[model samples]
Target chain A: MVTTAAQKPILLSGNEAVALGALAAGVRFYAGYPITPSTEIAEVLAVELPKIGGKFIQMEDEIASMGAVIGASLAGSKSLTATSGPGFSLMQEHIGYAAMAEVPCVIVDVMRGGPSTGLPTKTSQADIMQAKYGSHGDYPSFALMPNSVLECYTLTIKAFNFSEKYRVPVILLSDEVIGHMRERVVLPDPATLEIINRKAPTEPREWYRHYPDKTTGIAPMASFGEGYRYHVTGLTHEEHGFDATSQEVAKLLEKFKNKEIRNTKELTMCESFCMEDAEICIFAAGSVARSARQAVRILREKGVKAGLLRPQLVWPFPKMPVEEVYDQVRFILVPEMNVGQLRKEVERLRTNMRVKVKGLNVLNSVMITAEQVVERVLQIDFRSGSESEGGTSNG
Target chain B: MADATNQTAEPVDRHSWLRGNKKFPHMWCPGCGLGTLLNTVIRVFVAKGYDKNETVVISGIGCTGRIPVYVDCNTLHTAHGRALTFATGVKLAKPNLKVIVFMGDGDAVAIGGNHFIHAARRNIDITAVVVNNSTYGMTGGQHSPTTPLGMKAPTAVTGNIDPPFDICNLAVAAGATFVARSTIFHYQQTFRLLSEALEHKGFSVLEVVSHCHTSFGRINKLGSHLDMLKQQRDHAVVFTPELDVEKARAEGKDLVIGLLKKDATRPEYCDQYEKLVIQPSQAKQNRGGV
Candidate 1:
């Protein structure tokens, strides 16, 4: 069915935008367990999916939900699942399985405060590392962080496109603030947006190899009921999807998939604000990015040259964008909800550049306000040579 | 492959239903009941004439989970204890596709208990083949949820104190449309139960009581697989009221076999969704109601 086109500037929360974005991306199936801050996405899809012949199931648990999403996608349905901290941890097992089997599906983790249900109704970006290293083994991960209601729609669409085209799992990292905040934005007509799907093999059934080696490093996928009768297992497998213990089979699943996904530079998107002639760069994402935007304006009005570099995708790390910030600014301050999570990624890319990176981290179950970021940036004495090498401050 | 007895004109083309001839000399140990169960499973698929393309077999992690690898059909080998959830998605996506799940006793009643009961409660159209070997054989003879009381294993070295589960009774209590139990020694009964499960419209579970002699038996001093099979064959009896009930109990056995429940009138999951959710939405759409 064609998409239900929209024209008006509708008021929608970030979670609601995600539900609509999934519909526009042609997601026909969603299996998820409702968790705090993310349940609205499930609620919206539960109401909307049936109107367009789509399927929505509230599974027994997060693990079952992730498993069901993979199964639906294998049966040729575009699928998605949404969850939060503890639930996201449960989904890591199947997330790794989807990576090895090369099943195209999306998982949205609306970040909440945690070390196991630390704060249910509060916001945090603590899942930054979990998005990449949560699951065992080496696999490719593409994570997109949306800072607003509008971006929640756009990036969820991008999430599906990347998951399908790369034949790998794509994670949409939505924090509690982005998931709950309501904003008025004109929704894009679904036809005007880009929607990419996995390429289907044109060859006959007998000649089909589920994971054929290609120069582009991605093989066409065939659905389960399409008479292909292919095998899919979590175990390491050769091209035809049968299990094998050889090193060649082990490298086949990880090597090419990582190369193809990481090489796609377009997947790593970053936004720059007020950096025409700036000295201090503010780095943040998701809810903190919105605060950083406001902090940039306050800093400029106060006669301090401050700019912002917000990365949309955090997995491939977007080193080029951060390097651009390093070249233009000698001091960088990262304000985030979690104490030194995304800040660690920024410091890791410290490179050989003689720049001072500091983090204004808050983990009090509250957001890092714009005033706190401005206060921390003003206090960073970049002239002190001893503190020039990467330092941190808890707000 | 074991030929089905007590039947007329059963399909004999077993090779056609199996994956490839190279996959033969399967990885199962000699005298393993899983192999016997697989042999009978293929015969049932052949006899029932299930399409290799449309029939999707899903399994969770364990020895029983590996059965999908040998079936020449659309197959999925999922994480431990998650096959029913996966099979639920497959059946919901394409209701016409035949979805079957193979799970071991531990994979079914232990780690997968929540999913197992929920799948039956939902009355989803998927047949679950739970091979109850009373132990986690793949993990080297750890006692499972179905391991008999006082049975010995590596995990239960001093003899298991935990009471065992009845797989069919669990399914029946969980609202499954069809439920049955039969030992591998009762080959004909097991064959019939599996065939019935495949054809059932809603959630159907056929608990095939198997013996892991290498694991569950050897540690308990139960001799070889043949001895275990002999014990099962001697104890198991068809559920019939006409038999001598007092005598059977005195001999240490009773009605422990045959179909426990079959209710065809219960509404199926996918059918209910189509009727209750889709039809009204489509009606609203046709009438120009947003």
Candidate 2:
């Protein structure tokens, strides 16, 4: 049912909203293998993309699906692939390859409960750390988390934009609950959205170096068959894409890892609700952010002045905003679907603040509900709190 | 075979396109069969009049994988066992371009065996020249899938127990439109087979038994590059018009040089996909009167 013009609008599942968002974003190629919760995305793209002159390939496996998307992207097509926990695990090596090669593409991980195949259709935020550290070696990656279908639609578009802007693989870390559940979302016209295209080289073919110009952090990428001869590899390479084994070259490549991300500070978007006046703040992302939001309102009505800090851009950690909220709030509460994944980051930065930081960790099939978060926040006794003292609850 | 032999046999000029870099003078070791096989591929490409820019060469990880880097073309040196997969993408993405895969026996037969079978089964418009050097020469003389039984390699000191795969037979069984086998010592014969494979409309595999002067030579006591080449020449038996698969297998000899099978019944991968994907889009465009 549609709400008033200002209130929550139409109802849609997170996966359906993402499909619509990709369609609106002019996604022409979708190559994915069927996996739990994320399979709806491939099914939808298969039916919808062909109507728009786009192509969808259900590849033999996750490895080939990832390869197909990379190939499609090289051929001047905006492509994406979606998978769950195990499939995402299979794609880790190539994800590193994409990062090293600076290929612009989007990967959607509808995270299921797992170290292996914990829960195929069940939801968990356990993959938060995996998404960051799963791929071997040191390289920067962008991850976006959406707590609702509306954000799922908007953030997926943002994912594509960030992929193009930074010229690196961007991940939309949506969980099974957010991916499968229905909610209200609005589909805006394509013209209203700000689309980012990759920066093409202005220099002539002979003068162009593929990985040159470390000043901007991102080198201009030339598509194949464009008369500009360049090399790309999974190895640590020089400006010409040849294998470079020197320490100085390694340092130069490492500089790119930080520069590409540091330039896109505006892309780091977050929302703070009643955090300015609250003594207790709840930090969350993805579906748990919804529970945190509701918990804040419930605590506020009870005169506790509790607030919620939702990170839209999970990577780069949103450190500045968290540090800003750290000054105003005496107690920080983190509720996650997994066991204390993102809580470690919050605790590391909570030094000398004398704040009672607590984590509401859960790994079973159940999600962290608003009532559970509220109960955890209320149980934190400010009178007995100390620098060394902390609380944890397996909800 | 009749039509291929009847075609003009102009001696291919190899010097004009050769890049003169003495430091990397023939990156392949002297008398390595890959050098001779590579010379044949280059000559065939020239004879077919393929522009260097329009040709795409893909290779997997091995000594032979370096073939694409030396060639002046749109080249991709992909990860192990993924050259055919990458070539599939390259050809499907850009249907007009001519895609070729230069892979070694271990690269194509061991790790990339699945991709090889699938590419042939689909009959994609691509040519794969597999340089079968018997052993995994680049990584030391290890026993590969194509290494003959009783062959003493570093990994198989007791002699390899695994039976060798007849790659041409496998390719023909997997539905390749053109399947052929040749040796590096037979330079003209190798060139002729490669030229025909390139001209074939569907997936074509040309298995060239090349000499590995470093690993195989050291193990088998074949001292020099010339000695190794002589061994390949001695072991290889040319298939004739009178021989069939049963007759060839019954002879207890590995039929080395000649086309094994040529069939054009099945449709190519791209042509089938285009009919299913691109044709409808074209129809809609026509209806819109664009």
The whole-model lDDT of each prediction reads: 0.86, 0.77
User: Relative to the unseen true structure, what is the C-alpha lDDT of residue A319 in candidate 1, on a scale of 0 to 100?
Assistant: 84
True lDDT of residue B70, candidate 1: 91
What ranges in model 2 sit over 4 Å off? Answer: A1-11, A245-248, A351-353, A382-392, B1-27, B240-252, B281-290
Worst 10 residues of 2 chain A by lDDT: A1-10
Per-residue lDDT for B75-164 in model 2, tens only? 677777777866776676667778899899999989888878888888989999999989888888898999888888988898889999
Q: Any runs in candidate 1 off by more than 4 Å, and if so which?
A: A1-6, A256-262, A381-395, B1-12, B241-249, B288-290
Model 2, span A319-360: residue lDDT tens: 777777778887888899877878888877765467667788
Best by DockQ: 1
For residues A1-395, write the lDDT of model 1, one tens digit per residue: 22364577778999999988899898999999989989999998887888888898999999999999999999999999999999999999999999888899999999999989879999999999999889998878779999999999999999999888888899999989899999998888876899999899999888888888653556789998899978898888877777776776756855645644656577669888998898889999998998899989998999999999999988868888787777788788888877677777887787646787887878787888889888778878444346543444555
> For residue A43, what is the lDDT in candidate 1?
92
Top lDDT: which candidate number? 1
Error of 1 at A246 (Å): 2.4
